[model samples]
Target: MKLLLYITLPTILFAFYSCKKGEVAEVKQYSKLKVTVTNQYKQPVSGFTISLKTGSRSISKVSESDIYTASYEAGGYTLTINKTGFIDFTEKIQLNADELKEMQIVLKAGEAYLKLNSDSILRLPSSSLSSIVKIQSNTKWITKDTSDWIEISKAEAFGDDEFYVQTKANLSDSIRSSTIKILAGDHEQQVVITQYPPIRIKKTIGIPGNVMTQTPSSIKIEFNQPVILNNLQSLYYYCISGTPLQPVVDSNILSFNYSCGELGGEYPFSISVKNTIGDTFAETINVGFYLQQLHFKGNIVTHFVNDKDNSFWLLMENPDILYKIDMRSLKIIKEYPLFTNARMITVNPYNDKIYIGYSGVAALYILNPDFTYKTIPIKLDSTRLKYNQYEELTPELYPVNLVFTKSGIGLLSLSYNGDVGNSRFWFIDAAHGHKTWYTNAEEMEWYPYTMDVNYDQSKIIFTNYSLQYFTVFDSKTMAFNKVYSKNTWNQGDITVASRKDANVYFQQVYYQSVVNIETGSNTNATLDALDAARFDFDYGQKNKIVGFRSWNGYVEVLDFTNSQTPIAYHYYRFFNSITNTLDGKYIITAAENGNGDSWVSQFPGEWFREEATQSSGNTLLKIKQYPSLIRKSQWR
Candidate 1:
């Protein structure tokens, strides 16, 4: 009995000791764990809130920095870390008591969207119908909440899947960069935003002759605000009127002087606009002009001349005569007569002959090619043959915008015909003496800003300043082909670069645009803050439109090679001089009269210049250039 009792007591004691040791070991074996979160760049990520759960039991710890320390009972667990605009990170953590554990996590920044090919909606020329780029495809521009985007593009391609495009761009101002899993639809070819280029724009009045031939000069670009040239390499520029390469000059200003040397014509230039930001606009001016020796008299003599001297042709309104005068000698070297009465005059390609039209006649004269005889009237009237007794028709009138063709054989005229109680174009065939083609309209669809014929007469483009429409027609048929219209185009001049490809530049008051017409699906740029007008683009200077000039009494030239903005070129304040001529270098602004009135600046004796310097005395025709002498030898 004593032996049995001793054995049982030893067994019980051993069992109690084993149970106490097991509890002690459990308390010492489990440990707390510390973790740190970071980005792929190794930058510490902060404000990572982590939520932990075990069989419906849950706890949360949000860290000020990326590091966190938490105690865990011996168990298997799941952890989730979250931040704004960042992907939530999840990890499986195994823990124990009495020991330290370490873990590292990484979160990535995010991206936003894909670049849409807006050409489908905007320009989308007829040729791109095969690409199958549909509308509303790239309109998704936002990212998922709490997740950062690293790129916006195709991520996976499995067996025979079409080539998919990918975007790897990030935004710092709105969100962080992110790397995401992506898949593309089955498209055989992929298109991506390989480059984002800024837009280039220009606008100007196309040379008058360019309309007949469909050739233009550099497009003088005018913007509503300053042009934002964000990317230099992304821009592709072309002049619509002036020289093509010259559209972008040494200055940032766009200039196109296409063909100034063409004889017997007048030309103007302007710009069109585009950009990667989906910016697009056109010039406000339909026609731009460069006034030379603009005599304030109603019978003004504005002539197109070579810069070297004043040797050029003059448009005389009094008798409706076009004269080729020698700048060196004030002699009427040659005279070209016209019909009705003259109001405005212009030449083709800066040629030897001239063109004159009457203010109330539907006639445009094609002068003799040799400068000896006057151009005969080929399209004659039938002497008010048939008419309604109740309807009285007035004579046709010609606007003051025109140009000559290179051959000097054709004269392009933009005549205002109210005889039919409507506005229409009268294409006079000089060779056949008949109306060749016409675009008739009952209302004034477009008030002519300027008229231009290209050097080849293949394209005909015009701007109706009041209508804000750019009408491109077939030069041969006078048939409408295309219309460049939308909001943001100001009423101004029109011009073309006369190129076959997208190298077309045009502008208005709103912006400038440059593009290859061959791939002309979208505008190349959009700039802002500029005022361009008809009195800006002068294409006779080799089709290159030097920038706009202001009429501040002095000459205001702009150098636009440095930027989309313009810089002052030359300024000359004129002293009121009556005896001094305003044109031919030595313009005869001074005419004797005053208490003696001969029309110019009321003066007496031989003739004197007007003196604005001395206001209180006799109104003497005074000038500061010649001091007190008559500028007799300076007419040219």
Candidate 2:
């Protein structure tokens, strides 16, 4: 009975040596049959078992025990076995009764390789859009990533492909959708699912230009825009590519196309606004030059000069520096600092000399390069004038506004007697330091800011807050002549009658009053009371008080001819139809003084902005992005 029971032993005793050009294994006690199973690389497979069977009985399963024996009971049969991911074994072998087969089983059929994405993928959120997709399966398993097949994931039938492999899902394909099959031997497969990102369409247009130079423009689109405008650059710009093509300047109006190359093209332009649906609407216009303006709701001190060139007005900035700005250019020509407490700057354009009063040092010097400049030490030495009271022409005690006449230049030096003392004025000779008389020196017990003298250079208006008083004095004599009771109406908010001109002016609390300097009266001065309100008097424009609209309704352009019944030339609010910006075009809010403020800057194109601050060690923020008007041609 030739019962040939076969046994295949897959041993990992010694890793199979790589055969050279032609190398054969050395036969040992039992004929060697190297056996191993790996997917792609030559790695030992554990879960997969190889076996040799004879008819209904398997000879033995491979093991590391040298071999696996088969029981030869009746007739003999051939043996065969294979691994799940390996090639089938086909060989004939003779088996002894209860014999342990010691042979190697070299199983090398390669790995079933496939490719897939390890991580899960997700579609981006959709915009205002619609999307659709068709997925085709590469394998018939229709296997899901997880148990819940609906919430599909990226669990692919991972295997490197050796043959053609692609699963593109189209509306029409003749691949029977998908199919699954069980191969006779081990195999590798893959699966692919198609997905589309949520669909959306977005578009935008832009206008780029130099604020000073001509404008430049551009246009781009989102794939699904209604229409697109390309290469929209001209002397100006007007282009939009949003869905529905809606355009707007600030949000007030709509936008449209207004390209022009006709006769005389539009040089000046205003801001143009458009609706979201590509429709043109309103626009703000700045027709002329220098449209930018900054409205400073602060204080401005204007000093008068008496000279050859007659520099009529000088704006006093502070106590130390004097900035001579040309009104025409609004530019600071020279900014010189006075070495002393310069409370007053009286320039004599005729002499081309600038006189500065130093109250602290008790000195008066001419700032002009060629004037007789001198400093007077006021602690009198000889004269029996004694350290008497401080009044007009006392000493360089409290310098404020200076006055120069045939009697030399008088330094309005601010003096302090006590907490309530009004500052006194001093007088100095033009050539040498000559101290003179003191008028109303007794009233300087309180500190007064402006000690104004009348045209006669005699009467003085002293303002020490709650103590508004007036005193009349003789020029050379310095005698206390007449004392006029001063109230908030007379001296506190006082305005001197113009000796240069013929206008009477004064302020009571907040109301500006105009009366005759000779009669000390205004026959027709309106007393207006307001709280947080200010106005600019148009002395040249018919006394038209141009100010905030809510101040007194329209402008009080009154012709006080009757002195009793006041009449209006035209009831008008300055801001009624006013374009708040300097150019009368765009409107912008700026952050200042810990708050956002709105202003009309004077130089339409001037730079008006807050200071710069350091962000990190290097980063900086320019809060002063001066907004301007969008040109009208660019609006469309």
Candidate 3:
């Protein structure tokens, strides 16, 4: 029965068997994945390899044709495509058994090369325009400006285009520069831009050429462009002769309101003006002054021979050297060395001979006009020397203060060995070279530091240091007429000036008092707080007294007719001595340099008085003028 059934096979079975035998078919557990690669421009990409990966297993031997085919198992697979000049493509794919899947991939081209129209750029700081930078590239580009002053109108753009780079106005004096970077994918280009500094023009200063009747109120300067106010101080200078003046600046105008001094002459000055950017402009100008200057090699203690030619004999201390200076040429014609420990020098008005009193010896050195000299010993009366302790009866006469009368009589305040028993005031006949009388018999321990003769040479006003007393002596008889004790008048290092009214004005320390020489009555004068150690007084007409604070470099003018408050007070540097011409038309101040040299400055008395009157009520003027005066008076 089984044989008969097998022989009679079904037609469907026979057809299935014949089809399987002729095709040799096998069941597949994988799928075919087709990957097609194209560029961003939609063009086919060749020479690319496609990798099929699953877990840690991968098949990367599949090369790219028109389409890339890879047999992947029925699971999740990762497809990685790589090619030159294109961005690699990667994707995850899912395949079913015996299923055919196609994947379309687009590749991005590599970074495009970027080109700039110019690699370097230059512009002026005054330029207000923006610069346009053109880029030649196919890829999208971006720009970055590193500086805040530098601006980019278009920071990023697609493809090649023109970008704007702008800059603000550069107000600075220095040059400024910046760099801009243009980036396109991996390619980059840089543009360097530099801006030059602004231009500055020279300015002109207008100065008055005429003689200044008063202090200049203002000085104007014209400029082509606006300038910085702070920079003006460093750019301009004002000088009289060679002395510098500190001027206040208000915009382009400079002002000076203090007294310019009484010197009368042509004052040549130079101005070196510069801009904020260091551009310099020079100008030389001359202005007339009412005063003159005479330089000396040493500190001038006394001067004689006031003439039109300005020739004078000067007595200097600290080595005892004498000099004859010719003011016209400002030269020292002659100098003489006096080998003596002298404290005071005086010129005999009758014979014009020089007399120097010694502090170490009881002698006087007489110097002639031809430089010849002789020493005369001072003789003390042994009968009157009762308090003298020396064994020789002739003690060392230390003459500290000396004053000569018009009749060639010398009043010397002397001390013997600085002892209390031998201090005296002596009278000597300067013309005869002999000591006539002395106060040794009347007073003991009287150390006189200063002595002054009255205008008529009738009275001598003497002040003592150790024993505080002011004594008045009869010039003819050498007798003590009156004595002011320390309890009544506590003054030291006194200076005396006789007025035309027979009134004596005296200053000791900071106290000023007026005494009636006829009656010996004193009235205290108003005085400012003076802290100086040395002071000098010059009494002019109209009850005006000019006081010089030597150590502090201050000049104070007091009008006795007015209140005690100083009418004019000014401060200067290196001011040591003060003097006035005999005619009282000018006031001269002596300033010492660091080199031990000195300069004489003359100022108009009338101008100074007028300025003081004008500035009396203006507190602002006082405050402003004081500092400027001090600054200008400093040595260069």
Error of 2 at 361 (Å): 2.8
Quality of model 3 by C-alpha lDDT: 0.56
Winner of 1 and 3 under lDDT: 3
Q: TM-score of predicted model 1?
A: 0.33
Full-model lDDT for every candidate? 0.38, 0.34, 0.56
In terms of lDDT, model 2 sits at 0.34
Q: What C-alpha lDDT, on a 0 to 100 scale, does residue 462 get in candidate 1?
A: 59
How does model 2 score by TM-score? 0.35
The number of the candidate with the highest lDDT is 3
Task: Give the per-residue lDDT of model 2 (tens digit) for 31-143.
Answer: 32434434345455555444555667764565543234434443344445555545554455665544444544555563432233221222212112222222332221222
Candidate 2, residue 490: how far the Cα is off, in Å: 6.9
Name model 1 segments beyond 4 Å from true. Answer: 1-298, 301-311, 318-340, 346-353, 361-364, 369-423, 439-447, 455-457, 476-489, 493-546, 551-562, 569-636
Between candidates 1 and 2, the lDDT winner: 1
What's the lDDT for residue 255 in model 2?
37
Q: Stretches of candidate 2 above 4 Å error?
A: 1-320, 328-333, 348-352, 370-373, 380-398, 406-411, 416-422, 427-434, 439-491, 510-512, 519-521, 529-636
| TM per prediction | 0.33, 0.35, 0.49
What is the full ranking by TM-score, best candidate first? 3, 2, 1
Question: Lowest lDDT 10-mer window, candidate 2?
Answer: 605-614
